[model samples]
Target chain A: SQELEQSPQSLIVQEGKNLTINCTSSKTLYGLYWYKQKYGEGLIFLMMLQKGGEEKSHEKITAKLDEKKQQSSLHITASQPSHAGIYLCGAGRGGGADGLTFGKGTHLIIQP
Target chain B: GAGVSQSPSNKVTEKGKDVELRCDPISGHTALYWYRQSLGQGLEFLIYFQGNSAPDKSGLPSDRFSAERTGGSVSTLTIQRTQQEDSAVYLCASSLWAQGEQYFGPGTRLTVT
Candidate 1:
């Protein structure tokens, strides 16, 4: 079974600061997905990275998959209060039908 | 298009009782999954249903947990003789394919006393 370990169980940053959250997998990643969740709400898909060395960005958030596909990072540039939430990384192996293995998630708080 | 939806946004049960959580996947989705999230913890994969194929139950925490998909659309997860530890949010997700991006429902918060 694949396991994902996320760094910095939680993060607090001042508004307009930059932050990064990392997700490391125990097995080779066939696909990596980033999602944001407001407390008590369903997760919202952020980005998905498949190919090794692939990077995808939406708005102020960017995600990159390592060449080895064993690790990925989510970077938020000029973060704002809206970016405050739990950032979760989900890793998948093989086909799309397989269930993903997820990390514990990083709780991000933006200070005004 | 409507995304995945779960019934009874919140549930409170007593230990030794049984509970059922329902999930309605998006129309035409070929894959559905169930996951549990303990307070302040990450998601734990519970089971998966893909089309009419046998579901993957390897992630089920114990035999007391069981699930069935009806007509390949709605899924129900039943926890028999629930324990206090069973308190958590049960989330349901669906995707066009198993490996594609999954859409998640708001989830049912189950609190066992």
Candidate 2:
């Protein structure tokens, strides 16, 4: 079974400060996806990275996949209260047909 | 275009009762997936359906849990003799094909007392 280990299970940061969350996969990641979730709500897609050493950014959120494709990182620059939520990194094993293995998630709390 | 949708946003049932949750995928989407999310936990893949291929049920926890997709569009997950451990948010997602981004539904919050 594939596993994704996320770092800093929970984080609290002051508004305007930057934060980074990492997800390390036990297997080579065929595809890496980032999502955000508010309490009791469905996850909102953030970004997806496939190629090794590839990086993608949307608004203040940026995600990167290393050359090894075994790890991915999500970074938030100049975070705001709206950025506070649970961030999840999902790793696809092979193709879109395969189920994604998800990390436990990083709980981000942004203080105003 | 509308996103995936699930019915009965919230459900509360007693232990030993059977519960059924429904999911309606976006029109034209050929793949649908069901997942379970425990309180403060990651997603647990329950089942998946892609076009006409045999459903990948490897993620189903046990025989008590089963799911079926009708005409490759809507899906229903049935839990027989539900236990307290079955309490979780059931999420549904759909994608245009097997290897692409998936849109998700609000999810059905099932609480077994």
* Error of model 1, residue A20, in angstroms: 0.9
Q: All models: lDDT?
A: 0.92, 0.90
Native interface contact recovery, all models: 0.87, 0.56
Candidate 1 global CA lDDT score: 0.92
Candidate 1 lDDT tens digits, B1-113: 88899988999999999999999999999999999999765798889999999999988999999999999999999999999999999999999987889999999999999
Per-residue lDDT over B32-72 for candidate 2, one digit per residue giving the tens place of the 0 to 100 score = 98999996656988888999889999889899999999888
- The TM-scores of all predictions, comma-separated, are 0.95, 0.96
Candidate 2 residues lying further than 4 Å off, grouped into runs, are A93-97
For candidate 2, list the clashing residue pairs, or say none: A96-B98, A96-B99
Q: Is the docking of candidate 2 incorrect, acceptable, medium or high quality?
A: medium
Model-by-model DockQ, in order: 0.81, 0.70
* lDDT string, candidate 1, A11-64, tens digits: 999999999999999887888999899999988989999999999989999999
| Interface residue Cα RMSD of candidate 1 after superposition | 1.0
Against the true structure, what is every candidate's RMSD?
1.7, 1.5
Using alpha carbons, what is the TM-score of model 2? 0.96
